[model samples]
Target: MTMNERIVQPQALLSLIALRDRALQAESLNALAFSMANDLYPVLHFHQALVFAQRGEALELLCVSGLSKPSEDSPYLVWLRRASRWVASQLPDQQPHWLARDAVEPPAEIAEGWAEWWPAGLWCVPLQRHDGQRLGLLLFLLEQPPAEGLQQALSGLWQTWAYCWAALTRQRRLRRWWPSRRQALLALAVAGALLLIPVRQTALAPAEIVSHQAQIISSPIDGVVERMQVRPNQPVEAGTPLFSLNETTLRSRAEVLSKEVAVADAELMAASQRAFDNPQSKGELTLLNGRALQRRAELAAVEAQLKRTQVLSPRAGVAVFSDPNDWLGKPVVTGERILLVADPAQPVMLIQLPVADAIALEPGAAVTLFLTAYPLQPLKGEILETSYQAKASDDGVVAYRLLASVEGKPEHARLGLHGTAKLYGERVLLGYYLLRRPLAALRAWTGW
Candidate 1:
């Protein structure tokens, strides 16, 4: 007898007993399949083994012995794949296949490659449940076909292994995919309610404190600012001097007009006396009177202009200007803005909404502002007005201007104090509220 044949008699019986024990104790499908393949090594005289699992009407190679990943174009893989497909397509009445190199006719290229890499014969066993439902395929390589006695001994063992593998794999799949009935119902209920919930949509913009009703103080005539009577942000009463223009030129003209008025008065008196003494001089006196009146009117106009050179606050408020030096030496024209006399008690919000970040704004929309200086203390306000056209902001960005009135302004609130403002809009779904910007960006990208 051959040395291998003598050894297989006792080894085959021992391996069969070991396979039954290991299969019952295995925890996972991988462990069980790997153990079953290992236990059959001695009895089947196989060098390599592969396990494939059925997935959606096709077989997926799950585990391999002696390799990390198989190459797609390998000769042994190509032959094994064909054999697996043939077994998968078989009728229940057909038995499992034991293929030899000469029995199967494949492409010449595959045959040539296969001869160099693998043995001449292959054993393919179909894994199926007790009800005859196909699970997958088991593949092994051998030098030659097994003896009839050995095949008879392994036939029943193969059926038992298939049944165990199918049951373990199915149990694991069911546990992974199926949750408890209570958990499923709760998840569905939460999803339905979340889809129906409504939330307020908000847009953010930069804002600054501004006066609601501020009187703008400007120069009435063209002149250089000579002196400042009040400092920037200083409180002032009505008729208070904010800053005075260079009155040197205007005063000089007034002096000239005064001297001309005196000369006209003296001439007018002399002309009147002449009229009283002689009737011929009476016509001359009328002309002299006209000249005197014209000079007097010119003097009055000059005096009025002279008075306007001293700029004054029209109402009691705080002066708002950048710096005293900004206006002290600056030349101004008629009606050029110099400063703002704002009522400190009536500060409002001026928001600069960038064109890209702007949304639909309406009067009475709620707004919350968090100042950079005092981020923890938020100021509440409501939108009062919004500009239809965009204007250049102080920072050189094109933005829409919005006016808002504070609800309860603090005593420390001052004009030009900047903060971030959040404006609330119409209610919408929570999903829409969060995804509004992303959806807008997607639309812009797709141009739809």
Candidate 2:
């Protein structure tokens, strides 16, 4: 009752009363009601108060004040919860009630430091819906003696609290329903307008060419990049020499070893031929000839090292990315990315389009891309790629990435430039685009 003045203010009450309209959200009601209960409770007593919510729940803490959220969930509150459920279940009508008038006393088991606050009288009251359907219960636990007139005041305030709860809860349900109803009517009006107006819109579809995209390319081998020859935006042909590594020592040793290996191989072959003529010498040649094979293998290893000195391009593309800060003249290790060459002849557009809209992009669709850098120019691209792979954003929204290809050489276009595309796709009626996602989510949630 003490907190009732602020809680029952005209504005908040109106918000609550609006709940029954079948057009408001239950959360708004819950929030407003929680706020009122919070403001009202301290006026009554500072110990603590909670305006809990219910579903199948007899009551769940909707909001609380007076006790900082318990460092741990308070056991006393836990006891009240079980007891409330037991009591509500016993009633023929769904509502909260006096689960325990004095059946149990607060025990040390309830919370830490409980010995300081001994046995207290506790009670549970029902929070009923406007139609008198019970939604949850209200619990009151206090020192052994509730002060004079306190019981009366609480009882009087309980009705107001219940009204507030019912109004707010219903309003929540209404907010959602009303929007849906409005949308239905709006859709009808839109359909009517479409029938009356003569207009045609072109359809759009995504393109046929999509490429795998990666940034921050890594090197394939572990070696110091002795040299870096490519510059930013430098276009290189496939297998073009991009850089080289120091192989002076490796090459010279390889040549010397190769000559020795060739000599050994020649000697081994001569010995094998001689052994073939002497039938009993077969075993002798096997043991004496393996050195030639081993030496030849060593020579091949040197030759491979010589080849790795000249780093070659794996693909034909423009080296659009080479961080000067981390590049050439610097000692780089194997697997370090010296450069990134995106497929220049076949550059694809990457767009993170929302699923709601992306679903409309039919395969082989067309789109218009406009770049800010070239405001006067427009490019045609096709949606050749749509990935079903969706990722959840930090805020928990789902989105899919799409790839579209521009038709020709991109003049003044740069990688990662901010550009917008008006993608054309299937010609669905306008309302489907607006309503489908929400309707789908609702159906999934309700299973109806």
Q: State the C-alpha lDDT per candidate.
A: 0.80, 0.59
Stretches of candidate 1 exceeding 4 Å from the true structure? 1-197, 273-281, 430-448
Poorest lDDT segment (10 consecutive residues) of candidate 2: 199-208
Task: State each model's C-alpha RMSD to the native.
Answer: 9.4, 14.7
- TM-score against native, each model: 0.54, 0.44
For candidate 2, the per-residue lDDT at 7 reads: 45
lDDT of 2 by residue, 223-282 (tens): 555666677777777787777766667778898998988888777777778786787677
TM-score of 2: 0.44
lDDT of 1 by residue, 187-210 (tens): 999987896789887888999998
Candidate 2: segments with Cα more than 4 A from true spot = 1-221, 237-240, 246-282, 313-317, 324-347, 354-357, 388-401, 407-410
Ten-residue region with minimum lDDT total, candidate 1: 86-95
Task: Itemize residue pairs with steric clashes in candidate 1.
Answer: none
- Per the 3 Å backbone cut-off, how many clashing residue pairs does candidate 1 have? 0
